[model samples]
Target chain A: MEIKTRQFKAVARQELNNPNSRIFLDLLPVVLSSLRQLAMASFPDPEAAQRLGGIIRAEALSRLPELLEQFEKNALKAGAKVFWAGDAHAANAYILELARNNQVDFVTKGKSMVTEEMGINEVLEKNGIEVYETDLGEFIAQLLKRPPFHIVGPAANVPPPEIRDIFIEKGIMENPTVDPRELGYAARLYLRDRFSRMKMGITGINFAVAETGTIINVENEGNIRFNKSSPKIQVSVMTLEKVIPNLKDAMHMLRLVSRNCTGQHIGAYASMDTGPRKKDEMDGPDELHIIILDNGRTRLYQNVKTRQALQCIRCGGCLNICPVFGIIGGFPYGWVYSGPMGQLLTPLLLGLSGCHDHIWACTGCGACKANCPAGIDHPRVLHYLREMEVQGEKSLDAVPPPFTEDMAYKAFSVIASNPTLWKLTSKIIRTVLNRNAQDGKLSKGPGPLETWLAGRDFPQMGDKTFHERWKEIENNPPKAVLEN
Target chain B: MKTVSLFVPCIVDLFLPDIGEAMARLLKRLGLSLVYHDAQTCCGQPAFHGGRNPEAVKLAKRFIEIFENDETIVCPSGSCVVMVKKHYPELLADDPAWLKRAQAVAERIFELSEFIVDIMGIADVGASFSGKVAYHESCQLSRELGVVEQPKTLIRAVNGTELVPLNGAAVCCGFGGHFSVTYADISEALVKEKAVHYIASKADLLVISEPGCFLNINGYLSRNHPEHKAMHIAEFLAGKQN
Candidate 1:
């Protein structure tokens, strides 16, 4: 996806500051932190955690291929048709064709990050099918026509009064009130009618089981259940990497996923099945379709340092702890996922153009890496990505324009290789910049460093380097040592 | 006793020469033979991090030439020591000779606190300071280098210097090598958050190993909030001023 830099950030910034996000995040931190504390408190012993973590990793990795196959089988078994998309354009075309096939005049979708990346809504809407976002947070974002600032908490930055204002304008709510529960209930009621009647329901998968070819959806709101169960034709869309080997793996992932995301032992519902509803079941769609998208996961899987990004359960721990992510917020990430995962995924999924603007944003602090259950060395991966950017290597997107940075790096190689030049630079620094007298401090400077001296008092440079100062003291000293 | 080589980081070589002298005196007092390699300039941190690979490799090879025979290499800066241990191998991947040398360099490199604890086997340096001192754990040193408790252990040796734990001890202070300028807005916010924690702790001095964090948090607090002051660990210990 070729994204214009400032335009993309503007959409993100607007979404973050939007009322829904403020309300959501303000309320979310208290809930999230409390839940995290509870989760940590209830955590199994270290030995048990290690065992569970191992199983989870094995479950996800082993089931990847078989899950793809099973999902294909179940999707085909359902009365609804399925399509294979190797890339973004293919997925968009496939969804477009599916809309045309269903004769879908209007489609209602729960927030699917996968679809957002594929530009599915835009594609379907451009083809004259009206797309309505049914998720509460999503509905708010759509009212203003912007991308979500967060993956799970689309409305994290939005506060209640502004949301009430937006709702008042959109004619969803009667007036502003201080109650969030009532607000959530209002959104639930408003979205229910569309959920019941939409011809097709679109949803993203939390996990796809390879054993039974089942797609599992985790939700607290019951909207997902409605999206999956109520529509005549339900289309489950997921990135190919979502596949897991079996039921056991799916359960293990669920343990971490539920706890990490919302601080539950499990989400309220873990709706699971390989195909359409069972013969005995009265509820659930008659036809169930699943579309698995590659979107560059295969390429990413081949790299060692980065492949662990797939192991993300979409838990946002890294974001909460990340100083950059916490302070700057998510919009600057320029894509669906944010924080550590985005730094890894954006480059691999959308390519370098979107990634470079961010890949450097990381401080190599390893907060994300430490907190990550998958043990992804996020800072290391970020550093490697930056290296890839500098080398003009095109894993994705355009190699930076030759005029952009090649000359600077070329000059660096020449300057670094020569001892004399290196010595000269150091000499100039010591003579001009380091010439000083007070308790080892630089009193003044010129050129680029003039600004540095403007506010903060400068530290003095030593007349001779430590090694030189030491060598002179021991070798031939009537010399007054630079006293400590 | 084992012989040790000193790799005073390039910045210390130029700016904080007293820290180097203090370290040398402290080591000499401890009775270990010291080899100071003059040929050493940098651990190739700036060049390697900047993606000038060949230059970094050339410097690494030069480093190996200068200090290949030393039994152990110690540096006061956790950040540079980590860079040398981690990034050096990537720099010399195509060359087997340098790869072996790179691994050898990594195997022996130690941060000052770790060298004191592991090599010297001394929990506290018989030093003294008065008033409250909050230790700032630089991320690379504490996390990557796993030297979290070393500074605390050393601080306990000093009489009258009470160690106060800084809030959000594990969070970065936004001194991520080019991160300070690249994401200045976030960096400023992070530093301010840290300053609040410092002020709340009501400590007389903030002690740190990594210069980046020292300058960043110190710079922010000194300018905007004058009630607090920051000092690097070396300066704090060597200055002997509470």
Candidate 2:
């Protein structure tokens, strides 16, 4: 995928102006969040259930190496081929080679963000191998050549009229209809043909259970099940963090992810593949290959602060509650991941320098943190990322913040730490800010305040600041007291 | 009478000192002795949010040194209290002495409503507003500090002030310190929606606990819908009218 993370502000502004995007953005969070609230009510203790999900993710990430090894060993024992790819290039190359060796003209894919991260479809297409996105939303997103608007619904924000136009253009539908069901049936029929004829299928592993050496994929549309069952050769790609200690943990995560993602008790299909089809089996893949991709995750795990990001189960819960994501949708994130997840992951995967806008475009609202099922402290992580960006990190390819900002903060620190300097500076700042004031309000201003003043009015700095008035207020009873 | 040290945040100190005065007035009426630490400047929120950790550390130490000895501390801004109570310890983690002080100060500090309703066990502060009012839950105060019910309790206690429902009241008003300016467009969108909700609630006044939120929401209301008013909880509870 093209990296447009640097265009965050431009894209975000564009999204904000888009009325079509606004309708979806407003409805998505409210609907999904309320549904999530209802679904979570099923738990005896929702908070504890959420906390346990966090614990599971933390444990899995902390014991990541051991869990990955155990998963590989068990997967190999179960007659599945396991390949470890250090990066996206390696992962894509392995998948491309596998497709070529199988003599397959095309491969059907079950919605996999990791595959998008690896740019697998682009690679396969460039190599003349057709790749069909079996997931209905993903199929629309792919045909439209756009990034996923939301994690759960790639084309969810894309309006029906737009989908109808794209479906017609892609020859998926003969009749032009804005109805979602009709569009969906057209996609199903189109994808179904590919599913039946495809020799190879690729999917993303939701949970790679080390206890049973089974790879699990959960989906509502049954496309992932078909991807697992119809093909002779099946390839499942997983990030190392996907490996859990046991099936019980996987079940626990399934409960969390389902409720958090789409507010479902459970996805329609929870297909698990231990390995290839047995000799006695009538159907299922003849070859089962699992590729474990690192792709900057190992480096992310090296730092204690960054490692917490790996705990995310990609439930899109954060997106549903994030005010920033609610306003701008997903395109501004300019990568495979969007919302708080994108803010946390993109900076780590893509260098901080390139992802400057992506990281800083948050309100530091803890809604994402409070809502995350995986227990990722997004605001804290974002703060850490901001620190790294300001200070610069060699390993992460981060450059130090601009000289002006650096100096501004330095001056701010000096003034803020000393009361006398603070008072003096406050007076100077007040006079300058109030220069254009009318009726004790500055309707517009220059510099950083320009943007704020564009849409809102700022109060003129108080004539008598709190510090200056304390002496008088202390000696006299409060007005409320005097009134009584 | 319990003595409460006032940690007036920089925003309240400069932009909205009325909030600080209101807080002082409300506390004084409740029979709490208020001590204003004039030497205190900031809680290092701007520096911390700007990723200037060293500068934030300096300000944090300054804050700790000034208020560490107080029996109890209260502030009008939840985000500032969060800065001292939550981020300060993490920022000072490398320095044991400062971290210890930060942790101690963290416990002693409380947001105004939290201090009044929770610690002081006084919900009715002898305040009243004869109109329907909706409370805007600031992000850090509500979620980070979990100080939701305390402010609402105080609002409900006010004579004739109906605590009306505010749709998406807990959603951010988008004054994320520097975020309002840097990502101004997105911030504007959010604050606009907040104003929309506030207007739709038909509440005579919208009350907020945090001054940052007050500046943002009131700033928008001032420009776009000058008639629609929002007040800090301090001012509202202090019986000050907009």
Candidate 3:
């Protein structure tokens, strides 16, 4: 939640050195990709599913204002209150006010990135209200006091030994146990009391149906279901783009969301909430509130190139497949979102200048684009962000050019246009680099080449240019080479 | 009777001329006459990826003017061919006249393996190599260009050559031009992971089509694991030393 994205280099270095994270990152993608491929095979046409997902999100975004109003009216009619927050500050203040007004001491929270984006836990704690993360991963992350490593499995990368120690320190376990089942039991025992005593609960809405004021939360664990149904006061928070036109569209999108998010045909729980308890109902929340937070999304929506980022279902598929995240994990992203989606959204939300560090980390491999169920072209969006940084757009003046990359590119273009000039430049660079070469390759380089030479060798340029060889080949062509 | 003009990438021109020479030899052996346009140098990918649109535009236009007339244009590098086929239209999108030329010239460009297998209809190339060879799928050729099968088919045709499968073959080797140098740690980390899988395959040679992957993988192999080797597909099929 805190903006430490500018420290990507340092964070990446730390992550790369941590062998624990590397082992987890390396194994997870292989397992997840296979699971996803298998789950996706069940669809008659996977591309069609992705296209439908993209189309539904695009339609929602095209008429966002109307859909939000429709959702508000329908929700109000269903006896649930709807509140609008323009940004993170307003979102945080409203939640804190709700807590204070009700004299609530402790609240249970389902996994919600929007809440993290608003820094609600810190705000609520500052106002003397305690918040408990009900999601298993989030609970572990809370115990460890670190940001979630992955979107779905936030503490999945964190080793069980470390978790055992955390549980022991937190007084939830009598002894350290490496077995994850024991840890789960420990967590369940600890959170069960909190669930029974908690007067208020909070959650994130995966999809909001506009036809009826219904919100859907899909999860493997049943924490969110309890967080919503067991508590008297319940609030579901979502960003503006989470709303869909109707239940049919919501169901259509859910098929891809579950499959893409964690490679599941269906999550164990799909808790759908319409409103509070009625006289006929046995048990439900007494109060239902939905907070739609903008927080820079409206600005992002105005830009055509960037609105594609909103289509993300937070599947974390891109993160699992991303080689960058495969090495560094999510901390370097410095926010709730990570991987391809984070690289695009972080800069848009945190301003390009400050968050431009991770934006440039993308290798333009297009793996994220290929894996995305939403059809978000992350490389294109990332390149657009880089271009914004290079051109020093009005919004990005605060982001100084990290290096003279533009100047080098300009020089490259000039040399590339004229073959004679290019020939001369290549010879000069090769000659200079050869002085440091050993065995036709420079094992250790000087100046800027040090980065490349840090681990791998730079192959020395050939003694003669291809042009020189081509001239000789032309003068004396190979005689009857092979069949010809 | 196909007349193929060779689009030698800037890196091939300077760093690895053997690849270009091998390509020329192989294409000639397949009975395709080759034309080398000396005016050609770079494909503007470095500038294009670096976000210098205006400068990349200049180089891209130069490429169009030089190669627009050639009916069949082939290059040893997948990255270069991708630049011409994919990004050129994007670069010159604002200029209709240039955009048309770029789009036209784009259809004419092909990577070496794809051209050999698809256009020339020659997968074997009447070549033989006796060893276990793992074909590293350069990102541009396999994922970006969708030429995944062409290279594999060619490799399988080589007599006595066992084509071993590579894990994460479609993943990047992290030789993203300036990316290797700018983000050296991440780049090195990636290439190291690549090397680990490559070694695990127990293949004597690692073959690739793109100049960048060739340079990066060979660079790592030559330094860390000197016994291992990586070669461009052109050089490997030509029975030439990589």
Candidate 4:
């Protein structure tokens, strides 16, 4: 509201005061349990739920190596070549190498956060190649020269009229009032040209089934289908985490990840491309490469607490449901993933110094935790991050240890151990607070009391302590007081 | 007839003392004994929301220390009642004495609606209210604690009141604890949406169990839609009796 406003504190305090916050907080357990039920169940049956949950937990960490070997097997069978990229840089180079190997300068790209993560466009464009973003939102964002603000609805912060304005500025649409459909058609026309002529198509895999070496691309606009089917050389750069054991689970994953991310039952395009189209196949790429990029994930998965991040289907439910992410927007995560999943994932992958604040800003309300299909306990991870933060701060020698506690924690530990001491302390604290009440109301809440008042009104901390009243009633019982 | 211990949440005690009285009177009518633990400053709802988690435990420990006897601790506010029923055990785990107290208390800590519906085992409490009333589902009560059905069930069980659904009926009414004040703009947006739903629902009386929801809906009704009437669930029930 003001320039000097402590936005984070203000936002946090405001969230704390919200009635919905309480409702949501209380509602969380039920929501969590029910969603857990949803995630566990493939058929919404008891056995399927347990079975699916068990499979995920058992082999979630070892997904990468299994995926590479599976890809080798499946791709070799399908007469396709596979490349391995140790990191994002190598992955970008490998994709660029594919483009160069094809003698290609123009490429059509689909919406891929992983591509953004790898800085594919920058690397390719700097090497004097043309990249066309085929997804409508991605196209607008590319035109605006900005990374996507949202994963699913990439420009949530950009109003429709503003987007119309952007479209007109780019001359993609002649009128400023370009309805979303017309603007989409414009991109379709432009991308159709790119699709027909482009030598190579680049995309990201939502999931790669190890059983078939099948790469699944989930898209609303069918650009992923075009990317997979049209290009002479198709390279889908994927993080190793996308690999699953088989196709049945891959279909089940599509069923959940789509609904969870888009609030729709299914995306329009859920095409599974296994290597370039075979000679027997009716349509698709001649040269197919599934670049399995490790990119520091192997090390991240080495630890248990951080590894569930690998389970992120990139559903973006964590962003949409997040109260903070809803307001501040997602570009601030400063990377491919944002919101609850990104915070945990990016820190482990990119290093904490860059994305530690992602963990710090979380309210730990567990909306992300509850909604996560993978049953990733985001808040628990956030709690882990918080403790790690305190430890890291100590390690950094930022704030001297003496100042972190205000005689309060020390006093609490001591009193908690001795009941007599705690009782004495509560009695004294109540007395001092009650004394401040002028008209049965303590208008000015003191010290730590101020944080409480940031969004609430506190009456003088009860004039008569509960203990005193309880004692009095017990000694000389009034009928109602005694009955209570 | 079941004997229920009444936990009058701190907010009800101070701001809406009458609700506390109504809850007591309502329970008495049901042949239940009301035991007011006067020493109860709070269920540590404030401390928990403030993230003074240990202090919240401190407050809870003191509560268990003072009221270590056997009785069902039923609080009127879902906010505090949930804290007692659920979080209390997590807080007192290290101390067995306190843990036992927490476990015993949690088993009995019921929100007023829950106590009336489940323990009292009556959907309709022979209560009737006049006017078109749409109930706001407090997040904690509905989502966190899973009491969404109880209040609606009771409202339906009541004869006179027409139960109407608000738009995004399950959406937060911007009473995200401290959210109403801190992110006033967005909070105000959420409030306005709820108010618009109320207008569309054409409910003359808006009933909510939560004090925080009561305040936000009141503010929205005052500043924007001044014509709509709102009353807490306790106030509504009390008014019916009156």
Candidate 5:
């Protein structure tokens, strides 16, 4: 997928006007968030439950290298082949080689953001191995070649009419229909054929338990279950941070993930794979390959602060609660991740140069922080990213802000530090801004105010600022008698 | 008499000074002595939000120097208070003396409603309003400072004022300091949705605890639905009988 993080404003404006997306943007977030609130109420102490999730993730990330090694050792002991890939190319190469060695004509896949991040499907297709995304949303998104609109639902924002067109074009349905269930049924039939005949299946791990070397996946759809069971060969990939210390931590994370993602008490299926099928097993993969991909994550982990980006559980909780994401949908994020998750991670993974706009788009609202089960302080992270961008960091490829912006803040600091200067500057600004006033408001102004004035009338600067009016207010006697 | 020093935010100091005056009146009416520091400038929120940490640190030091001596410091803006209470310590972490001052000053500072209900233990300030009103929970005030019920407690105590529920009341109004200007399109969409929810609520007025939110929401309201109005919580609770 193309990186459009730089085109945030353009895509956001386009999405704001697109009625098809507007409908979903308005409904999905509100519904999901409210449902999330209700589901979280089931916890004896919701806040404590959320805090525990954060503690678990933080502890996991803190001991990430050791946990990964332990997980690899235990998985290897369980007869699973554990391959450590330092980057995306290595991971993709190994998977491709495995496919070629097995002489697999086609492969089925479960919904996996890591696979998408690696552009694994494109690589496999380019190498003449067909890849089928069996998750319904992923299937539609793959067919349309669009990034996931929402993390949980890849093509969720795509209107039914558009889906009907895509389904018809792809021969997923015999007749045209706009009903979602009917479309889903059509997709189910279409993908079921691939699931049965596919020799290999690929999936992303939600949690790789270090204690038991078991990989767990929580999903509403059963495609992942099929991805593990029906194929002769199963390849599950995870980033270095996915390994938790034990299954208990995984269970706690599972509760938070399900409740936060779709407001369910739990997902429809929780599948765990310790290794490939035993000789006595009736239905399971004969060969299980577990690939742990780093792909710059270790570089991120080297910095104590940036390591928080890996704490994200891919639950889409932050996306649901984010007000900015609530308005523009996910296209403007211009990456595999969107909302606060994308805003923070994209800058780290893609570098600050290309993802500058994503860092500054937040309202500094702590909604994402308050909602996150992983305990990531998104607003603080964004602030840190912004600081890095303005100051420039060689390691992150963060270039210092433009001369004009740098100078503007410098001037601001000077004026703000001195009260006399602030008071004087306020007077001059008041005089200049009031010139554009009509009916006590400025409908138009210069520079930064121009964008604001386009949609809302700015209040004319007060003639006598509070600083100028303080004496009179102080001298006046109290107006109301205390009613105690 | 307990003296409460005022830390008027730059926004209230410039475009919405009436909020500052209203805060003074309400505090004075509650029998507290108010002191306005002539040398107090800003909490350095814009600089901080702009990612200019050095600039923010300079202003944070200046803010600390001005207000650190006061026993109780109060502000009408939640974001400014958040800058002082939350970010200041972090910004000044490298400097031990300033970090200590920031932490000390942070404990004494409070948002208006927070000071009133939590500190002063006053819910009713002999104020009255006649019509239905809904509170727009400013993100900084409600989430950051955990000042959710303080403002509402004061509003609910207003004689004849019926506090109504607002949809997504705690969501951001999109005036993220520089965010409103840089990402104007997304900001407009969010503020528009906020206005839409306010109008749908059928309340006569919307009350906000932060001046930044007041500017953004009231700006949108004034332009599109000029008939409706949004007031700072200080102004609303300062005995403006509507």
Candidate 6:
């Protein structure tokens, strides 16, 4: 992903106005939210499930350094080669070199956001290696040369006709078809050959248990299963914060992720690999390579307030319930992550320079916080980010807002503090506004009020302040006022 | 008799003083002695939520000083009540004594319907309105203040009123103080979506508890769908009773 997050206004305007995108984004969150609620009924204690999910992630992040070391030692002991990459550049380079060492010119990849974050597909293609995205959404997205629309269901909401055309253009379909099952079959057939011949399989680790040297990948389609075992070598790329304290916590997180994501009790397949196959095992990879990348995660871990960002399990629940995401979709986020999590991560990881747009885009409705199974306080973090941005602590690339916006807030603060000042200011503004009022409403507004009045009528200000009206009658002021 | 201090929000004081007057009339009818502090101004919510905490602190402290001695504080807008209850303590966290005072003041502050139903134990205030009425769940009231049922309970208590459930009623109306103008496109889309849902409900009038939503939703309705009517819950109940 190129960092066009700075162009959020233009991108969001386009997405908001596009009928196709609007229809899909509007319908997705409502459907996802309802499914999640219905699935939540199956839990003996759903609230406890939510709490435990958050606690486990918090525990993992608090002891991340120790847990990562423990996970590395145990994974190595279990016969997996573990490599640590400090950032996306190193992670991409390490994976490219590993492919060269394994004598592979092509690799099969499952649904891995880490790879996307690392820009691994572009890196491999540039270096003369064929990379095939096997997740049905990623596959279609790859064919279309577009980014995923939603985190869980990347190509899920894409129009069937467009996908049908893409499939026909790629020679996957003999004829154009809009049926999803037919399209799935076409993609499966096209991808099966690549799966068999690809010597290296790349995957994303959903959770790495520190108690045992185990890495788990949860998915509905079995692309991850084949991506891990159908090849001579497997490379799993994960961020360092994905580790959990134990297998018990990992199981709890799995249940939460499944229900919150697709409203399923469990994903169809959960591949938990301790390491490469032992001598007795059959149909497994000969070598297991786990790449744990810490791309700007440690900076978050060091900050007390922002460390909460690391607790995200990538369930995409926040995106499914977010009103903004429901309106404009994912591409406007301008990065691998989207929605509340995207708002937090983009500014933190990509730096505020190119990504403050989405961060500022949040309405602070707290819907994401309520929907998050991890109980991540996204609105609070967003407010903090906005405050930081306003303070100019980050993003030297960000241009300052017009003086009117800043001065308005500053002037409001002064007027809000003193009743005398507020009364005088309100009187002057109201008198002016009322003078211009037409038929009990200000049909046309001046300055910034134009934006508000453009869509809605501004009601005429009242003739008298509440205080003035209250004082007209002979009444005693509050006892509290006299006491003060 | 209950003694109450009325916290008149800046908007209510300026554009919609009738809401505050209606709230006062309702409180009086309930045998509550309401005191209006002439010195009371804004709740600092506009500045506080705008990321101007230092400036908000002056108003917040002034607010605490004005209402600290009252038995209870009632505000017509849930948006202001949320600012007082949730953010005041945070703004004053650096000063231990002020934080304690803010926490205390927060405890006694309530939105009108919450004070009426939860504190006064009066769901029915002897009001009547014969029509389909839909309630817009103001984000600060419903989500931030957790006063979801209080407003609906009061609305339903009005005789001859048929409460209609609105789709996406709990979603924001995009009156997020400065957000309406700052992010005009997104804010416009949200309010328009809210209006569409309200229109779909086929309600005769839309009722709301927070002034911000009352203004924002009604503003859109007046411009785009003038056939629709929206009013503050205080005005609705007070008008019927008086």
lDDT of all predictions: 0.71, 0.90, 0.86, 0.67, 0.90, 0.85
Tens-digit lDDT track of model 6 for A110-218: 9988888999999999999999999999998888888878888887657889999888887888977899899999999889989878799999999999989899999
Of candidates 5 and 3, the better by lDDT = 5
Interface RMSD, per-candidate values to 1 decimal: 4.5, 1.9, 2.8, 7.0, 3.2, 6.5
For each candidate, the DockQ is 0.47, 0.74, 0.60, 0.12, 0.68, 0.49
Best of the two (4, 6) by lDDT: 6
Q: Write the per-residue lDDT of candidate 5 for residues A373-457, one digit (tens) a residue.
A: 9999998888888889988887888988889988888898888877788888998998888889899999679899999999998
* TM-scores vs. true structure, each candidate: 0.89, 0.98, 0.97, 0.77, 0.98, 0.96
**lDDT tens digits, residues A24-57, model 3?**
7888668888888889889999878878788888
In terms of DockQ, which candidate is strongest? Answer: 2
Stretches of candidate 3 off by over 4 Å are A396-403, A444-446, A479-484
True contacts kept of 5: 0.89
lDDT of model 4, residue A37 = 44
In the range A370-438, model 1's lDDT, one tens digit per residue, is 656554668777767767777777665635546635675556555545646655666677777655535
Tell me the RMSD of model 3 versus the true structure: 1.9
Cα lDDT tens digits for candidate 6, B44-64: 877766666677888899899
* Model 3, backbone clash pairs (residues 3+ apart or across chains), number: 0
Q: How well is candidate 3 docked (DockQ)?
A: 0.60
Candidate number with the higher DockQ (2 or 5): 2
Q: Which ranges in model 2 have alpha carbons more than 4 Å from their true place? A: A481-484
Candidate 4, residues A1-484, lDDT tens digits: the string is 0111113344444544545334433332345334644544535564454346435634744566766687679866876677778888898888887778778988889888788888888899999899888888888778877666667766544556767888777777686664778767877886887888877988998987778878889899999899989888888888878787877777777776765766555688789877788778889998888788888877767777667777788887777666556545555566667678877876666555445456556533456765676667776566555445434543212222243443554455555446456457766766776676665544455565544344333445454434434444334422322121
Error of 2 at A453 (Å): 0.8
